[model samples]
Target: MSAESLERQTRSYLSNNVPQIQEHGGFFEIQDVDDESGEVTVAIGGACSGCGIAPMTMNAIKHRLPDDLDDVSKVNVTRAGGPRAAVMPTKTEEMEEMEEYKDYSPPF
Candidate 1:
């Protein structure tokens, strides 16, 4: 298959099979496709940053993409953001206080 067709097929498969990715504000980008080697590189981004389930998603992609698509021998899936992106920002004191109040139950 041509690189363009392969990319298109990859996108379609991900969208149909992995609808949760989009529901969670995540997306997959096809970075490159080697026609000769039948290898494809994909970058996962958006809310996938720092997401605990991303590793599982990556593994799924690596194993499933090749099986689903013709001429795809190997799949390389990587997070778009680096290590720093995995660290969620700390909440401020005000935000913590708000949560404390929000969770409080008043007695009648």
Candidate 2:
């Protein structure tokens, strides 16, 4: 299969099978495709850069791509940005939680 075809197949598979990536504001980029060896390198970018679930996403791509696509023999996924510091809860989030129990009555 041609490189172009392999890329298209990969994109289609990711979009359909891995909806979480797109839903979480992340996307996969086709870095390299070797038609001879059937190896495809993909990069996860956007919100997935420092995402906690990035590892799981990479694993899914690595294992599922080959099984799903006939032309793809191997998949290598990499994240764009490395690890990031944890984000603190925003005021809005805190307020939303407070509002949920604002009307609660104590049983005591």
Put down candidate 2 lDDT per residue, 9-102, tens digits, no spaces: 8988888888777887777778899989999999887776556555556766787789878899999887554343233235423432465444
Clashes of each: 0, 0
- lDDT (Cα, tens digit) per residue for candidate 1, span 24-82: 87777788888888999988777766565565677677877898777899999876665
Model 1 stretches astray by more than 4 angstroms: 81-108
TM-score, model 1 to reference: 0.72
Output the worst ten-in-a-row residue range by lDDT, candidate 1: 88-97
- TM-score for all models, in order of appearance: 0.72, 0.71
TM-score for candidate 2, residues paired by index: 0.71
Model 2 lDDT, full chain set: 0.71
